[model samples]
Target chain A: MADFFNIIFSVDFGYAVLRVTTPILFAAMGALISDKAGVINIALEGMMLISALTGVIMSALSHSAGLGLLGAVIVGALVGMVLAYFALNLKTDVILAAIAINLIAMGGTVFVLFMVGGDKGISSSLASKVLPRIDIPLIRSIPVLGPILSGHNILTYLAFLSVWVMYIFIYRTPLGLRIRAVGENADAADSVGISVRKIQYTALILSGALAGFGGAYMSMGYVSWFSKNMTAGRGFIALAAEAMGGATPHGAMFTSLLFGMFDALSNSLQTLRVPAEFIQMIPYLATVIGLVIYAANKTEQIKRIQAHQNREARKGAQEVKLL
Target chain B: MFKQKRLFELVRTVLAVLIALIVALVTILFASDEPGRALSLFLFGPLDSLRHFGNVLEMMIPLLFTGLAVSIMFSAAQFNLGAEGAFFLGGITATSVAINQSLLPVVHPVLSILAGGLTGALFCGIPALLKVKWNASELVSSLMFNYVALFLGLYLINYYMRDVDAGAMVSFKLADTSKLIRIIPKTRVHFGLILAALTVVAGYYFMYRTRWGYRIRLTGLNSSFARYSGIQTASVIILSQVLGGFIAGSGGAIEILGMYRRFSWQSLPGYGWDGIIVAILARNNPALIPVGAFFLAYLRIGADLMARSSDVQSEVVYIIQGVMIVLIAAESFLAHYRHKLVYREARKTAASGK
Candidate 1:
């Protein structure tokens, strides 16, 4: 227990939490955007995988972090177009399509790795560029909070700002209303002359951008180099975040932060003398337990709803008979 | 008339196979492979020697069984991807049982295999229960559970089964009687092949020949209609998942027993995803599962051979898989294209009449 406390309060642990959550938060916001628009974006993981590859490759070629981020966004958009084509136009099974995209990305990325660097798993050299932190002079001087807030990679700020942007896009604007309408009732929105497919396509593209940005964070910001399958199921974790956050941007941010904290805690547990494998499995275990509990709660809600309906019907029948 | 439909079905299957081959050939060429050599190897590699041919058959057994498993569950309208998990756990269970054949000396090996089968079914049963009890999406739940089972299996092997004598990650060796004998010399083909075939045959009768099959199919096609038709759709759906889990579990046991001396798979065996493609390729026809598995096995064997003998990377086959499955999912496009072609021919005939 003392071991746990010492690790938890360590400066390194707090900073690691910020770093871990940054990519997950990016992916969660991306998921939130498309899910709000009625398309279930299961390819978030694939997008991140490819984007991470692209981010690293571009960084290697150009020696610029900005290009790495741009490369990731473009890669994300390309995959998004493929997904949108199948989902919005071809009218295939959405989840299955996502699965296909994932398979392709997995294989394609590995193939690219071998073709370029002559390795299956990772880049062999350490000369590739990585995103560096920037210090805001004013924020750094303020106190304890400034140190926490100021020294993140530039993309980290963009990730947080994206939450507010996504909130506005989902709730404030006319297009947001239309996207929400499409999600709630496609036929109703179609009747009102909203193009459900178009909205879905656009939302998916935006989602791809955000997901790609998340990948960029992984390759450039989180680590200085690329590794195979290094996103390591964070994309799926973002799916849990989307659900836990109530499918809203604000809610998703908090959930992502919470997951980030759990991830940080798990990472720290290593120093706290927990077994490495058990610590590694924490987020996935948390996902299963969290989902089961949430589902059970929803099922109970349905039962309560049915019971209330029965009571209301009984009351109405008795009143009519009395009248 | 009989020949016409038979010819059409043959043509359709042939067309699909040809398209896959052509795409593969074109990719090999684009990737700077010796097109002729790659093509020859891909086409004849599996049949080049008895060992490779046998290898294909051995690979086919698990694919056939797991395909039927997925087909059976899908025909019940539940997407439980837990067969992969079931297969993984089942392999470990089979290995464990085989390793301890001497300990349970009095018990029949038959009973031991049944225990292995039940262990696999139980692995899949968790997701089935989650779906039935919690209204959880089986797809998500099953996918999630695969990781849990994977990690747990890893932990089990690492902590308990890892042998100090073995240089790397592997389990304890099985007893002599525990290993499934290869019936053909130099061929990987074993009695498990027959078992796999029997499983498919049984699945056909289960889905199409039985009353219970009708209920499951009805529920799968339209649960609301089945419910209105007074069929217990929920129970049928849940039952089919259990049955599907059982077959997949058995397939895993068969694979481990037949292929390895120990349950040595440390990660996901790709049989489950291949099973999905097989199920799709069969169009969920239980009778067609063996054929689909054979085709897939042949392709896999061919790709490996092509990669070994040429410049083409083996991962290219995965891209093909993704493309093919996604294309298959667009069933409406195929139907629409066929409809248009038929209509055009009819118009030509009418104009000729005029």
Candidate 2:
């Protein structure tokens, strides 16, 4: 226990938490944006998966990491558009459409990977490029803070930076207000001259692009090779985080970091006597528990508000009787 | 009028399948060196051999269970995705019971299957319980529970049931008494086919003929109205999910006993996800589940044969399944044709009345 505490307090562990949180933060931000627009992007997992493969293949073919990232973003947006076409235009259930996207991604990514790299499991044969890391000049000079914060992958910095950008976009921009208005009440938004469908489309496309960055980070920076189902359940975890965060950008960032800490701990704990499977189950288990707690709290809040409203109504009735 | 509507649905389904096949052919042309061979094999290979046809039937058995399970749950408007985990753990539970040497021969498999079904119900019940008690989203909780079931099942296999001599992460061999009997002479098709058929009938009866079933359907169609009508929607939700899990669990047990000698699954068998597709194709109708299951099984066997004989991979079938599901579930896919037919009928009726 003493050793555990020591490890938890170490700068290395803090650094590991931030490193692991990057992709999840990106995906959670994506979930947040679309969820705020009343269109939950359950296809974030599929989008991440396909984008991961696309990033690897495009980087291998073009010999440029930036181009690979761009390609991944484009494919992600296209997938989002496909989902929009099916759900919005063709009147399919959005959840069912997302499930189809997941199924397609599960098989299609492996098929393409095998065709390109002659392997069904991993892209080790492909000469893929990895995104570069950056060391902050001023921050790097600090002692403990430098080790925990500086000299990380560029995507990691961008993932953190995106929180601020999302905050501004969601809280300040006119388009963001329109998206919120559409989400709050589509009929009312339409009455007020807002095109709910167009706002939702924009939200979903932006959501997919954020998930694309997460996928590129996975294949390019988090690790150097793309593997089958490499995104694992992070996209789902991001959904839980987004919900727990109340669908806010900064809140999602914090929840993502919390889940990422558990993930980093799981990875670090593998050297201990505990079984690897149990350790690996930690992040997923934490997600379920977190969801339950969040739900319970939400229910309690609703009950309190209802109680207050009832009390106010009784007071109004009593004043009427007195009059 | 009902007949016409059914015919329209049938036509739409046929159109969706045709479009999916065309898309699959285009994909094969791009991916396969010999597109002609791949396409031919994919379209006709399952019909070429009796054994292959038996394989299709064998595959359909598990699908039938899952499809019916999903149908029941979706009927109650529950989106519990825990069927996969339930199916997986059901197999584990059955394996545990099947390896016991104390039970009688004929009664052993029955008991084992029941045990598996019970385990599956409990597995899926957690999410339902949480949703009712804490207002959690069943969809998210069930998805999370699947991973929990997977890891817990793995731990049980590794620590409690590991056969050291097997040299792999597998449980002990199931006793001969617990093994399901093969129904056909030359094929591996087992008695699970009969059980699956029975389940389909029972599923249909439970959904359409029972008061509880009525409540479930009403809740699914309009929960607010169901609540106002004094139906216990919460219990209905839980009941439907538990029943679905029971069917899925039984399917897992039947699959393990009929197909394998030992409990050797290291990953979640994807039958549960396939169940979702089957349910969608059948429009959540229990009676049509067999048709959907058979269609999927035939396509899968044909794809497998194509992969074996040609350069094209079998994963192409997933692309077809995805496309088919999207097209079939899209309400507006053939809406214009249906509308035109309805308008013509209305005009004819007006003219006759005049």
Candidate 3:
């Protein structure tokens, strides 16, 4: 218990949490946008993976990190478009289509890697450019906050900034209103002359772009090289985070942080007597527990609503009889 | 009418496969310096020798089990995908049981296999129970459970069953009595193949020819209707998933017993995901699972051989697999052809005016 508290309260642990939260934060934001637009983008994993590959290869070829980031975002949007085309136009099952996309990305990356004379395991041969880390000039002067807030990869700041951006976009914009309306009631949105499909497509594209950044960060910012299956189910964890956050962007942001904390804890726990596997299991296990708790609360709320309605109905009947 | 429908289904499958093959061929043409040789090797490499043929059959063993597992649960409309974890835990659990030195010879393998199956059933049951009780999403929960099972299995092997001197994460070797016998003269194909075949047949009979299966099918078709008719839909869903888990679990046990000298897998063998593809290819039919499994194994072995003999990597098959699964699963893919056929049938029936 002492060790746990000591680790949690440390500045290093705080930094690690922010570092670990980067990819999941981006992916969760993406998931939040797509889901709010009535499109469950389960292909975030595939989108992130393919973007990671594209980011590395493009960066290596162009010798420009910006171009590499652009390439990944483009690929992500294209994949999202493919998903929309198949699911909406072609009438494919969304889940199945997403699964197929994930499988393709998984294999396609290795195939492309082999084609480019790169090993299947890692992209070590390529001297790919990495995203720059930013140290805040003003924050560096702070006594305790400096260590926790400064010297993170540039993407980490963007990931945190995205939360605010997403907040503004979702809550303070007409387009966000349309997206949420479409999710809540597509027919109603359609009735109001909002093109439901068009909004969904836009949402999916933006979602893909966000996930693309996440993927790019994994390869270029989070690490210097692209490794096979490097995203390692972070995309799914992001989905869980989004769900646990009650589908609100701010909620999703906090959930992502919570998961990131668990993830960092798992890494730190590796030095302790605790089994690493068990420690690694914490985030995923938390996802399940979080989901169950969410479900139980929803059920309780529904029961309360039903009881209130029933009591109102009984009172109305008694009033009628007295009259 | 039924025959016509079946024919259309067949055509659709053929078209999907053809498209997948063309995609694979295009990939090969771009990836390989010698596309012709690579293509030829991919097509005929698996049939070049008896041993190669045995490799296909050996690959089919686990696919058969996992395929049937997915098919059974899918037919019950439960998307519980814990088979991956179930298979992993099952392998380790069976290994733990097989490591025991006191069990009778005949009962040893049986006990181990049963233990593995039960462990898998229990592991998979968590998601089902959660879904039924709390209305939680089965897909997400099952995915989480798979990771948990993976970590738990690894922990068991690392702490309780590790053979440290072996210099890897492998467990202790099984006693000779627990090791499965090779039934073929020169191949590693064991009696497990026969058991796999028998299980497929039994699964078909159980699912298609039994009353319990009727309830499951009805539940899948419309749970509300099944409930209206007094079916215990929850139990049906849970039971089918449990049974599916058992099949997949035992398959894992069979795989380790038949092939390896010790428990060797450190990560998922991917048989469970392959089973999903198999289930899709078979259209979630128990009777067709073997054919689907065989076709998948043949493709895999062919790709493996091509990778060994040519410049093309075997991962190219995954592109084909992805295309095939998406196209086949897409309800609107080739919808016009089916629509035309159904329209013709409707016209014929109207003209008969019976």
**Alpha-carbon lDDT, every model:** 0.81, 0.91, 0.90
* lDDT for each residue of candidate 2 in A1-323, tens digit (9 for 90 to 100): 77777778999898999999999999999999888889988899999999999999999999999999999888888888888889899999898999999999998998889888888779989999999999999999899999899989999999999999999998899998999899899999999999888998998899889989999999999999899889988888999999988788888888999999999999888767788889888998999899999999999999999999999999999999999
- The sequence of per-residue lDDT tens digits that candidate 3 reaches over residues B1-354 is 999989988889989999999999988998889999999889998898889889999999999999999899888888888888889888999999998888888799989899999998888788888888888888788878888888888999999999889998898989788877888777788878999999999999998999888888889889999999999999998998889899999999989888988898877888888899999999989999999999999999999999998998899988999999888888899899889999999999999996
Model 2 root mean square deviation, Cα atoms: 1.3
Better of 1 and 3 by TM-score: 3
Predicted complex 3: CAPRI docking category = medium
lDDT score, candidate 1, position A110: 77
TM-score of each: 0.92, 0.98, 0.97
Instruction: Estimate the TM-score for candidate 1.
Output: 0.92
| Residue pairs in clash, model 2 | none
Q: What RMSD value applies to candidate 3? A: 1.5
Q: Best-fitting candidate, measured by TM-score?
A: 2
A76-152 per-residue lDDT for model 3 (tens digits): 99998888878887788788888888889888888888788448768988778999988899997787789999999
Of the candidates numbered 2 and 3, which has the greater lDDT value?
Answer: 2
Task: Give per-residue lDDT, candidate 2, residue B272.
Answer: 92
Model 1, total clashes? 0
Runs off by more than 4 Å, candidate 1: A125-127, A136-150, A272-274, A302-323, B1-17, B101-112, B338-354
Task: Between candidates 1 and 2, name the one with more favorable lDDT.
Answer: 2
lDDT of 1 at B298: 89
Error of 3 at A258 (Å): 0.6
In angstroms, the error of model 1 at A107 is 1.3
